[model samples]
Target: MYGIVLSRRDFREADQVITILTAEEGKREYIARGVKKIVSKNTSHLEPATLISFGIAEGKKEFSYLTNVQPVESFFHLRQSLPTLHIIGYSLDALFTMLKEGEADSDIYQLYISYLRFLNTQEQVRLLLLDAFLIKLFSHLGYHPSLDACVVCEKTYKEIGLEFLSATEQKPGFYFAGGGIICASCKAEKQRIGEVAYPCGIKEINTLRFLLASSWQDVVSFPLDEEEYRLVHKLIYEFMLYHSERKWDDWGKISLIMT
Candidate 1:
């Protein structure tokens, strides 16, 4: 089956356990026996994000072993660039943290493949692609943030009079616990209930809405200034962490790379 190596962990002696995201099987853990040996050809092919085809050997235990790996796309160029490498590492780390073992989702598998392909060719837009991928990944995982209207009141931005908010005006509040942007009215109501919200400027709010609504083709061309990019990155990263309930050590590193 065709798969991407998501992560690898050393096992007893020269063996290791490799977690692979397969096109057909979603995520599967396989034992690669003696792969830690000096002459093992499988070691390099098993690196994270390496795409390959391999056969599964059913073992007496619950897990399976990998055999006959044929490399498809190694994405070697990613290693040559520090920023791209960091993004790849962050992406893989997020995937590894969120994806459950043996859970099959073909859409996510395809999305991952597309992400790698894009990263392989487009170095300039890696950050944008990563952000877009994160948004889409959350959508695929059924945790898509409600960006169109107020999460609490369900009112449109125009109805809430946020569309005309000036740069100097107090920005709309983003209530992470409430799942999305809160209108002025709902923000007041939330305040009465002792729930605090994060302030998000009009530009940042609109940028996020566009991202959630746009395709990768369109998103690639979307213009974002350094400040706008920073806002979007912080919002998305925090949102993912809050919803996923997982703290990633690489978050600061990836943020630094984006800057």
Candidate 2:
């Protein structure tokens, strides 16, 4: 079957437990025997974010064993850059955390493939794409964050003028559990009852909406400066962390790309 390697960890001796996302099987782990041995050909093919085709031998037990492997696309060029690697790392962490093993999701698979294709062809790493990918990925999993208006109120984004960093006393922020942007008033009330929001500016909100709703071709041209990039990165990274039940290791991946 065709699948993308999401992650892998060393098992006993030369073996590994490889987690892969397949269109036919969603995400599943297979025991890859002796991959650490020098003669093993499947070692490189199973790298995270790689598109590979492989055979499997399923037993009556809960796990399956990898029989053979042939990589379809390794995203060679994308892996060559540290920035792109961070993007791949964060994206895989999200997928590994959220995807249910043995469930099939062809749409999500196609979405990730398209993302890798774009990154593979680009010279510069557009982190906007990473933000959009996370947004879309969550949408597929039924967690699309409300971007246009307050989740608690009906106020439209156009009526809002305050930015989180500039405004005082509980400014607007992306309420992760609330699944959208909450107005300052609502945020103030939520704070009294013990809830916090991720600070965001007006421009950040607009860019987030644009990223969420627009196609890749259109989004690639939109401008994203360093400061805006940092904010969006923090917002999405934190959102992912919260939703993933704090399963991710920061690894300085987000901070690594900041420089």
| Best-fitting candidate, scored by lDDT | 2
CA error at residue 181 for candidate 1, angstroms = 2.1
lDDT of 1: 0.79
lDDT of 2 by residue, 1-259 (tens): 9999999999988899999899998999999988999999888999999999999998667768998799899989998888888888878988888888888999999999988888888777666767788878987888888887888886777555544445554357788879888888787777788887776767777777787778776667877777777777677778777777666664335554532
The reply for model 2, stretches above 4 Å from the true place, is 161-171, 247-259
Off by over 4 Å in 1: 161-170, 215-217, 249-259
Per-residue lDDT for 1-259 in model 1, tens only? Answer: 8999999999989899999998677887899989989999998999899999999889886868889988999997767777778778878987888888888999999988887887777565447667777877887888877777889878887655544354335457788887778876677678788887777766777778788778766788888877788888788777787778767563434554544
Error of 1 at 194 (Å): 1.9
The most accurate candidate by TM-score is 1
- lDDT value for candidate 2? 0.80
